[model samples]
Target: MLVNGFYSVVSWIFLALTVFAGVALVMAAIAREDAYRAASKNTKQFWLIILGVAFAIMLLVPMMFLQIIAVIAAIVFMVDVRPALRQVSGKGGGRRGSSSDGPYGPYNGGR
Candidate 1:
């Protein structure tokens, strides 16, 4: 009984994480154009895999593969992509704005 309850709780937690991750991935795809360009194929594939596995688990599998993939993507973002993006944007204590563009404001990268 106790073990079953624990498993139930764990499953729900994983489900929530999976949903949040899916939403974040979608939002990142929308907002971060540079990231979109940098990892266009990988980003699309990642979203498809994560969301497909999430729907499969929610509707069919009950195995939580989506959560696993999401966790892996989160780790990659934190360790690899974040640092690379910081360097690319010159935000690693280097500069507030780069020669290419700034924080997607009204400046328009014109002058």
Candidate 2:
């Protein structure tokens, strides 16, 4: 019974990680291809293939070690590559304004 309970928890954890990879896959697809080059990151296709495989591993393979490896790939993409892509595309790094910046965006005084 204890083993069954532990197994259920483990299954849910893997499912959540798989979902995370899936979300990362979608986000990677949405990003512009040029952004990857501008950010000096790998091509978008490369990330797509890695993340797609990561998303698939949890579904097609039951090996915990492989799933963990895939999750690491997804994490790298999410934490490192995505931010660089966003910065290159002018969609990240928060507001780009002086100290008078407002919540919405830059708060430029009337010229």
lDDT of each candidate versus the true structure: 0.56, 0.91
Minimum summed lDDT over a 10-residue window in model 1 is located at: 36-45
- Model 1, 80: alpha-carbon shift in Å? 2.8
lDDT of 1: 0.56
Q: Pick by TM-score: which candidate is best?
A: 2
How many collisions per candidate?
0, 0
Report the lDDT tens digits of candidate 2 across residue range 1-111.
Answer: 999999999888978898999999999999999999999888999999999999899779988899899999999999999999888888888546778878876777874
- Model 2, which residues run further than 4 Å from truth? 99-111
TM-score of each: 0.44, 0.83
Estimate, for each residue in 1-111, the C-alpha lDDT of model 1 and write its tens digit.
Answer: 999999999878876766665564554454354653464325544655655455454445455465465466655554565555455555555445656564664466455
Where in model 1 is the C-alpha error above 4 Å? 35-60, 64-67, 86-111
